[model samples]
Target: MSNETTTADGGVRKKGKLGQRIAYACGNLGQAAFYNAMSTYFIVYVTGCLFSGVDKALAAKLIGVITSLVVIIRIAEIFIDPLLGNLIDNTNTKWGRFRPWQFFGGLISAVLLAVIFSGMFGLVNVNTTLFIVLFVITFVVLDVFYSLRDISYWGMIPALSSDSHERSTYTALGSFTGSIGYNGITVVVIPIVSYFTWTLTGAKGEGQAGWTSFGIIVGLLGILTAWTVAFGTKESTNALRAKAQKNGNPLEAFKALFQNDQLLWVALSYLLYAIANVATTGVLLFLFKFVLDNQAAYSMTGVIALVSGLIMAPLYPILNKRIPRRVLYIVGMTSMIVAYILLGLFSTNMTVVFIALVLFYIPGTLIQMTAILSLTDSIEYGQLKNGKRNEAVTLSVRPMLDKIGGALSNGITGFIAVAAGMTGNATAADMTPSNIHTFEICAFYVPLILIVLSLLVFMFKVKIDEKMHAKIVKELEAKLASGEIVDDEAQTAETVEAIDEEAKTLTE
Candidate 1:
């Protein structure tokens, strides 16, 4: 027999099937694949392949200009992400606010990515100034669509489940699948970009034509993955949106999300972690080539990391039952710090390097998995505290920080490259001993410091531990079951007192 029930909002409520959860989570695979490709390889393409055959000195100058523009675009996202998030929250449609955007956004993103890699500007022999302007404009447009899909996509996590353990399950599955997609690109990108030949010349010459072809394929793959989520999972038809729709000021709703104390702490901690993580990955290619003396090792490292994550993914839900999130965070951060130090100290030893990479990733994945659950818990906290639910706006914190972190990572890596004289010299063969040292310091030590700082912030500032989360969930569920709307003033006062009590308990 089919199970169905009606919520107080007069909308149908039912648990999403396992198949739906798996399919919806699969969307992350494509999203992660596309994002990882761009963040990890796009700069490499611009600096190395795009300018192939051009004068090295001239190309280097142009690359500087491009990198600067890229950084600016990323900074622009800091403002853009929240606004897009607000728009998504305010949006209401028969098909749902998220799936439409996910479908169309992924579709447009594919086309734009293909266009970027198509080398059409080369065909037209566009002037350098005109090409840069057009490329920047195209990239911005592409990113806008990406944000649309991303914000809406992740927003669905809380909307998909109100239960904390369920959120952990979905997030863990998403992270696992997403890692597959991400590593798939990392492992094969080199071969894909060199598999075929065309009239193109320079670094790989006509072989670089494969980039455009690969872009097209990946683009289409993105669309397929998006559809899996769009068609599969069912979003909660909660009364929250109906209540939000009654108030038309999206800006107020957006502001209210940041005002949530728990969410604020979570976002800050996640932002720091994201910055350190992406920044370290940003410099790995350089480290592999110049320091490790094996470009292929970069892909191997990525594959091993992803495989480690896959093995560790199932363990998170099990561990969540036994460990407090605060303890988990501490353990993960401590493990990562130790791994980074070991990797730095024994940089030239292949066995140590491989072992360190594995050790780093296992706990890193655990931390990420737990962070997702914690963030979802904060959604309930916001609702209980603020008398409103803004899933899209609240969840947007992750993507917003992601963009900021990526931009900062790029800037950090770019500076290190320039300082080491690696920027002007494309190939690792030109790297001096001093350059290698600088690379090691920037890639390893800098990220270690950043992560250390992240741990401190999370440990002291973030207060939503397992006990606190349980309290919030119990109170919210009770409030829902009562079917009585408490007065705004009274609700706010009670929320404050309850949260304060939890804080006091945590301290005691």
Candidate 2:
């Protein structure tokens, strides 16, 4: 779908260029690569290896405390996401609000990614209390920068194009690249952490130093990709923001968020999906290390995720044309549940496990891609209903839900590890058969349940289908052409001219 803008010359212009799609999609690869490494492996590093060989009791306690902190920090983002969104909305600069934040956020997040993994600044060597403080501080800072980049980055989607097809195309590209960057590391990280050893210290591959070295490489790569996005994609100001700003109620920004029905439903559904998705990824390390007794299988599972996304990404726009997003959501959720059940039944068989994962992730790709597209469309829904576009605040819902879900999943992983005596120097050999089963339950069943619950929220609440979206875009375009949507500054200038003309006539 061409994002048609009614030009001053009464002509329509297309906004989504091929180059812009490639550039914007490239950023996802960088950002996801950096973030995925941390979200999936950071907790494993801390609980599984960082405090290894300490007193079993002390190590367990430390894992508990640090895990708690991770949860708290993520929960805190519920407040932080919106505030950052509001800030992003209010910001004005020559570079554009989104790019400036995207560039700086990506840069800072890249540096912090290395720092977080490096365990530098005395974080790894410090006592439990001090480590928690440092960890929380670093995590929060990284999250803030991440939010700056994420909110601005995805927020730009609505600005990129208003057409549903165009939005989904960009979204699919982003999802495709992001899944690769995000899940692709799962294929390599474990192998690197498990088998590849650095020459400097000859430490084990999964050891602290090895993970730190890995982080540095990933962080630099993220910086490069992020820069690709910053320089490559151009954001158009001719979006919902024009009319939304005219109707913007700064003081009511927070309240306005809840009032947007499309945003609300999409956000709520994403919250559940994110929790399930994050938890499942969190459990992969344990699942590979403990139940499967081979860390290399992580790569295989990661391959499943990556391949499924690859297969589905290109198919999304095609599939979406045929199926309603709601139906797709249901099918995806149901497929995921069935796959998980099959995975649990065939837990010991690697071949079956791989097959089940392949099935699970195909729909998983659909779920992820559509969620992003849905959120992008919600910006128009908000603008149409509220008379103001809160793109940043609205887009912030993803990270907000993501962080919340990640926190829950991470917290659960930590608690499960502590309870099963898997924390602090615990290896696959140390776990009993029952402990392996517990890992499976966390890895598969919990997420299965969450997906089902989210499906409920999606079916009942999210009402903006493709047809409705098309109608919204058409109406908005008509308004723009008819001059109902006016720029605030331009309106002010026109008002000033009218007053001046009247004054001149009276004086004459």
Per-prediction TM-score, please?
0.91, 0.89
| lDDT by residue for model 1 (408-458), tens | 776766676666666534567787888878777877888889888888888
lDDT of 2 by residue, 288-393 (tens): 6777778766778888888888888888888888887767888998887888888778877778887787777888778877788788776765555544667888
Off by over 4 Å in 2: 1-15, 194-196, 246-251, 479-508
Candidate 1 Cα RMSD (Å): 3.4
Global lDDT of each candidate: 0.74, 0.75
| lDDT for 396 (candidate 2) | 84
Instruction: Give the local distance difference test score of model 1.
Output: 0.74
Q: Highest lDDT: which candidate?
A: 2
